[model samples]
Target: MLRADGIHRVAVEDPGSLGARQHLRHCGLDTPPVPVDTDGVRVDELRATGAPAVLLTPAHQFPTGVVLGGERRRELMRWARAGGLIIEDDYDAEHRYDRPPVPALRSMLPEHVCYAGSVSKLLAPALRVGWMLAPPAYRDALVAAKRFTDLGNAALPQLVLAHLMESGELERHLRQVRRRHRRRRDAMIRAIRAHLPGAVAHGAAAGLHLTVTFDGDFADAGLARAALAQGVKTQPLSWHSQRPGRPGLVLGYAASTPTDIAEGIALIGEALRRLGP
Candidate 1:
């Protein structure tokens, strides 16, 4: 889309989607960081960048977990209609545990939104199976790009995924995983409350990960290092942020059992104490 629109610059949420940032840089495009709040990416801030296009993870924002508010969605549509473009990465929209499902922005404004999804999160990442829905104007270009990238993804995995989708097995599997993930999410929240006082968890209502922010003077990168030294892995929120803010960590609980989640968080708490406020 950036190539087709003659746009060399793009805006992405600060402490936002890492995949989007990586891809933008890989293409040699300038990705100015925009701020995200309780309502998702700040469209007003995006406008300030004057970038012709913005990449967004609206349903459940990466790291932060904020959904795009209704008003902001309309504002984005207006922005797109006025010649700006939106690259919507519909990442992890299927794993909602609380509240009704939020509709994808593409549903309302297909012409301006380039939507992408994959079974990597659903089933496994090794499959490398996914699909894209692009507007007519950019469809051919995207396809050509995909073809040149790796001559397209493997076919057997795609066929297997198709069979799973056709047999309703995928939906059934999702239902099972949702239950497990919800339990894990609940476990992480409990662990946070018990072990890490003063830490606030964000985007708990959906997605495979939870972002916890702390109001303190501790350096998140140092804290992450300490946690890693204790054999507890974590991604410092600072690693994802282009701008400065409070210290935090982005933790994923999908693969961890509740007991492991509690142990890992407790180790993080210990690390925090060792590092001081």
Candidate 2:
């Protein structure tokens, strides 16, 4: 919505999270769908949108798990140099198994990128703690908007987080979770291979979840509901699409135990069978 007020069009990745588009539409903004490739959002298509800015999850793409490749990173830097704004959501930038951590795009193009990150996955979503760093040009305005929205995030949790940061407890917790999460991730991958052999998995290199796609006749949402009926919950790939993409599921492993993950995958396997694959 903020983009609609100042910009003519917003470039959102096609087959991206539609929740983002719905929020923009609620804000009375028009979104133009842009294509994404293995490297991330396609730069040429983004430029074609003629929009001044774009939103991206370059560190770890939402459903595809594809990191923005090196050349694409340079391309994005060039795009930002041409006065393009980049809204960088550093979601789950910390968790990884097979790859080293990717640097935040904001670190390279801080002047052009708005970086938003939260503790939703780190500690828990109940914390409601997230930070945003924007260019100075937008800082004052964003602060004003935030002030009007809630005067500021609650004082106590902020202080507690401050203590955690200062005491290094946060880092300690992150290390602990990273170790545990890696095991769960492996378990989930194993489960996928055992139960859903036809599916393709993505983003297993990091983060708490794995995005899996399969060629099937059933709608992703229907499959999701079927899984839910069997006491398993998952997000359909369609929930993220601004435009049609594929049939798949986003299976989260971090919050669940290894046993639960195996059971859930088994349930999903059963659901798929009940639904005729």
Candidate 3:
């Protein structure tokens, strides 16, 4: 859709999800970094980039988990209203532990927003079924693209997912996972405090993972490499940013057992110690 409109540059939040940037790159689009702050993506910085479209995970900002502030959302709406396009990715919005997920930006202005979500976050990843609500202007183009690409997803899975949704089974599943994920999130928090003394955790109110930043000018990539060498996986905060920032790790706890989460953080602590002050 963007190609049809001659939009080659897509603005992504700086310190955003690396996977999202890679995906955009695969689409042959240039994703320039737009600064993101505690209030979410900086609209002023994004506007300065002159990018016609943006992809966002605004309901719960990835990595930071901050919702787009009211002022920014309104500003974004104005931006989109003036011939801009928005792709809202509400991935893992349902897993929020602190409160009900905020209303999606797409709901406020469907004409300018392309809202995308998936069952992979709610159900199993193997299900692989997701959805996109595109604006009417691009619906036909998108459908044709899907038809030519993999002939669209498997019909059987789509039917099964539809049944699950209509039967309220999906909601039941989300409820179950919410409780389990909450427990795991709490466990990870406790572990971060116990195992990583100088590390400050952020964005724990929602999402399956949170970021922990160490004090001082520590190098997180080295810490991440050390952890990986010890058979533990972690994402360095710098990997997502086009600019340098604090040293931190993006850690996910939802899939691991509480014991394993604790052990992993302990290993990370050990790795950091091995790196020295």
Query: lDDT score, residue 240, model 1?
Result: 87
Best by lDDT: 1
> For model 2, how many clashes?
2
Cα lDDT of candidate 1 equals 0.90
- How does model 3 fare in lDDT? 0.88
Mark the 10 consecutive residues where model 2 has the least summed lDDT.
1-10
Evaluate all candidate structures by whole-model CA lDDT and list the values in order. Answer: 0.90, 0.86, 0.88
Lowest-sum lDDT 10-residue window in model 1: 1-10
Name the better of 2 and 3 by lDDT: 3
How large is the C-alpha RMSD of every model relative to the true structure?
1.1, 1.6, 1.4
Candidate 1 structure, TM-score to reference: 0.97
**lDDT score at residue 13, model 3, on the 0-100 scale:** 87
Please provide the root mean square deviation of candidate 3 (C-alpha atoms, Å).
1.4
| Tens-place lDDT digits, model 1, residues 154-244 | 8899899999999999999999999999999999999999999999999999999999999976689999999999888889998888888
TM-score of each: 0.97, 0.95, 0.96
